[model samples]
Each structure stands twice: as structure tokens, then as C-alpha cells.
Target: MTEPRWLDTEEMAAWNAFVEASNLVARRVEQQLREQAGLSHPQYEILVRLAAEPDGEMRMTELAQRVVTSKSGLTYQVTQLEKAGLVRRRNCDTDDRGVIAGLTDAGREKLREAAPGHVELVRANLIDVLSRDQLRVIAAGLGAVTRALRERP
Candidate 1:
């Protein structure tokens, strides 16, 4: 059998950078959201995704996809939001077995309150440190990675 191809120096550096930067950014975002908005990063993402819809609503499955979360994880987060009175869920109008999540006025207000600090923290930690060209390159590269992964099971 042939030996596995290992990462070379530059590839190894790139991999390390990706892993470290992603973790740092995620942690900072989580911290900022919690401090300023009493929300977790995943919870903030759920609110943002639902807020983007015209009706401030989306199917729970679609939301799980959009947030890159598992079905059970999404359900748990939604339950927390529901308890907080920021979100509501009901049977999907078109599919009895499906669920839909809707953002309440409280959710929108929470998002509005949280967004500024979130954006500032993101920019400070990642975006502002990177040049525009760097941002474009990283976006393209990560977009490809996500697309490839999503295409698989």
C-alpha cells in the first residue's frame, strides 16, 4: 500500500493558522455576545437567520442548516429562545410534521442591541486585521471548503 501524503511546511502552517484563528474568533464572538446581549454565538446566529426572512421566520431544518448546527442542537437552542420569549415555534403551515421558528419583537430588539458590539468585536478580532485582498482570498477559500463539505453526507 502507498503511504499517506502528509502536509508540507506551508500547508501545515496554513492549517494551523486556520484552526487557531477560527477558534479565537469563535471564542471572542461568543464572549462578546454573552456580555453585551446575554446570547451565545449560535443563538445570535439563529436570531440573525430568522430576522433575514421577510416574515422573520424560517423552517427549523433550514435554520439548522443555515447555522451549521445539528437538528438536535438547533432544537435545544430554539427552546432556550422560546423560553426567553424571543422566538416562537409552531407546525409548518405547509407540512404538519415540520416546524417553523419565528422571531418575536423581542428577538428583533435583542438583535438590534447586540449587532453593533458583535460587528465591532468581529472587526477588531479578524476583519480589521486582514487586508481586503486577504479577506477576499479567505472568503473564497473557506466558501469552497464549506461547499465541498456540504455536498457530501
Candidate 2:
């Protein structure tokens, strides 16, 4: 087997910082969303994704891809949203086998309710702590990581 290349001191520190910061930010977002709008992060993300679309709808598989979730996982979240009257799923007109998820008016309202606190918390915990250049670099780096992962078989 090939020998593995380990991270150097600085590289290790950067990796640790990235992991810790991500966890902390996620925890804060989870708490804020749960308290403010009764949402988990994934569910909140689902809503946000749907809201961004022109018709506020997307195929379940596409949503799963966009949300970085499995189809079953997205199905569960969408089910919960449906129970909460926050989302609706329907047969896709273009694809007989595809299901589309759409945000309801209540989902829009919930998102509006949750967004301000979420933005403020994120700003307090992450965004406001970073310079614009830092944010850009981080975004580009993470975007690259995501693209790499997605492109992998």
C-alpha cells in the first residue's frame, strides 16, 4: 500500500479549525432555527432552496442534490414539512416517476420568520468575524471541495 501523506503542523491546525468552526456554527444555527421556527437545519435548507427557485418548486432528486441529502432523507424532511403545512409534493408533469416539492405560503412565512434570527446568528458567529477577502477565499475553497466531492463517482 502507498504511504499516506499526513498534514504538517500548520495544515493540521487549519484542518482542526475548519472542523471546529463548522461544528460550532452548525450548533448555533440548529439552536436558532429550532427555537425560532421549529426547524432542523436540513429542513430549513430545504425551504430555502425551494424558495430560491422561480416557481418555488423542484424535483425531489434535484432537491436532494441541491440540499446534499439522500432521496430518502429529503423524503422524510419533506414529509415533516408537509405535516407542518409548510411544503407540498406533487407528481412531476414532465417526468412520470419524478416528484416535485414546493414551498407553501406557510413555509414562506416560516422562512421569513426564521431568516432574520438565522442571519443575525450567522453574522455573529461567522460572517461578521471574517473579512470580505477571507469570506471570498473560504467560499471559493469550500465550493471547490463541494464540486470535487460531487464530481466523484
Candidate 3:
């Protein structure tokens, strides 16, 4: 086989740190949302997406795509949210087979209540940890990485 390509020492350290930090950040954010808002990350994302849509709603498949979740996963999450009175499901008038997910008043209230503490957790756990220059570099780098990943086959 041809010589294997591997990360150099510094690159390897950065990669490991990025992975660990991402996991820790996600866990902490999820905990905060679940405790304060009765919402998981996926649920919160769905609600947020619906609330931000033109009619405060989106087609279920579109929502799944926006949230980067599978159809079954989004359906499960939406069902749970529906149980909590945070969202409602409706059949699309334009297409009988298409479903629409809408944010309820309770969902908006939950998002409003959750946003403050969620932002605080983000600041405390990640944003506040970086210096101004570091923050800029991180933002740009992360955007590039996200774009690359999304573009990948």
C-alpha cells in the first residue's frame, strides 16, 4: 500500500480536542434544555425551525432536512412534542400526503423561556471561553467545516 497519510501531532491534538469539546458542549446544552424547557435538542430544533418558517410551519420532510434528522426520527420527535402540547401536526391542504408541523403558543413560550438560559449555557461553556481573535477564527473555521461537510456526498 502507498504510505498512509496521517494527522501531524498538532493536527491530531486539534482534532481530538474538537471532538471532545463538541460532545461535551452538546451534552451540556441538551441537559440545560431538557431541564429548563422539557425539550431535547432535536425537539427544540424542530420547534425553532417551525417558528421561523413563513407561516410558522414547515412540511415534515422539509423539517427533517432542515434539522438534519431522518423522517422517522423527526416523526418521533414531533409526536413527543405534540404530546407536550408544543406542536401540532396537520395534513397539507395542497398535498394530502404531505404533513406540516406547526409551533403552538406553548412552544413559543418554551422557546422564549429556554433561550435565555440556553444562550447563557452556550456563553459559559463555549463562547466565553474564547478570546475575541480566537472566536473569529473559530467562527470562520467552523463555518467552512460545516459547509464542507454539508457538500460532501
Q: Could you give candidate 2's per-residue lDDT for residues 34-136 as a string of tens digits?
A: 9888999999999999999999999999999999989999999999999999999999998899999999999999999999999999999999999999999
Which candidate tops TM-score? 1
Estimate candidate 2's alpha-carbon lDDT, on a 0 to 1 scale.
0.96
For each candidate in the order shown, give its overall lDDT on alpha carbons.
0.95, 0.96, 0.92
For candidate 3, the 10 contiguous residues with the lowest summed lDDT are 47-56
Tens-place lDDT per residue, model 3, 1-153, is: 898888999999999999999999999999999899888999988988987877779999999989999999999999999999999999999998999999999989988988899899999999999999999999999999989988998
RMSD of 3: 1.6
lDDT of 1 at 72: 100
Model 1: ten consecutive residues of lowest lDDT: 27-36
lDDT of 1: 0.95
Clashes of each: 0, 0, 0
User: Which scores higher on TM-score, 1 or 3?
Assistant: 1
lDDT of 1 at 61: 93
Per-candidate TM-scores read 0.97, 0.97, 0.91
Clashing pairs in 3: none
